[model samples]
Target: MTNITAGDVIFLIFCFSLAAYGYGVIHYGKKHSEEEKK
Candidate 1:
């Protein structure tokens, strides 16, 4: 089995959270804009 270090885990979490936050922002913005238009 391959051993993953603490640094690797932290980096993975950081990247994942960053991507998730960006996705959420984009999704929320789109939704809000569409709601405003209606």
Candidate 2:
């Protein structure tokens, strides 16, 4: 089995962070639009 390196871990963390940030932005935008319609 291959061992995991620090670089691999860092890359994974970066990808996850980007995904989370994108999701948060989309979620907030949806909420704001719905609120404006009310």
Candidate 3:
């Protein structure tokens, strides 16, 4: 019981941050090409 309380929260936050960063990169990539054409 003690193990679950200490470790799980840290792991979840780390994963969530990575997912957010990936989304931002994809959005920027899509927009950048459009600007270049103009």
Candidate 4:
């Protein structure tokens, strides 16, 4: 089996961070738009 390297761990963290940020943007965007409509 291949060993995991530090670079791979770092890349995984970066990917997860990007996904979380995108999700946050979408979630907040929807909330803001709904509030504006009220």
TM-score of each: 0.75, 0.72, 0.58, 0.73
Candidate 4 lDDT, 1-38, residue by residue in tens: 79999999999999999999999989988878766653
Using TM-score, give the best candidate's number: 1
Q: Write the per-residue lDDT of candidate 3 for residues 1-38, one digit (tens) a residue.
A: 45565468888888999899999878887978766653
Sliding window of 10 residues with minimal summed lDDT for model 3: 1-10
Worst 10 residues of 2 by lDDT: 29-38
Model 2 per-residue lDDT tens digits across residues 1-38: 79999999999999999999999978987878766653
lDDT-wise, the better of 2 and 3 is 2
After superposing candidate 3, which stretches have Cα over 4 Å from the reference? 1-4, 33-38
Q: After superposition, how far is residue 34 of candidate 1 from its true place, in Å?
A: 11
Candidate 3 lDDT for residue 33: 75
> Going through the candidates in order, what is the number of backbone clashes in each?
0, 0, 0, 0
Model 3 / residue 32 / CA error / Å: 1.8
In candidate 1, what residue range of length 10 has the lowest lDDT sum? 29-38
**Candidate lDDT (C-alpha), each:** 0.90, 0.89, 0.79, 0.90
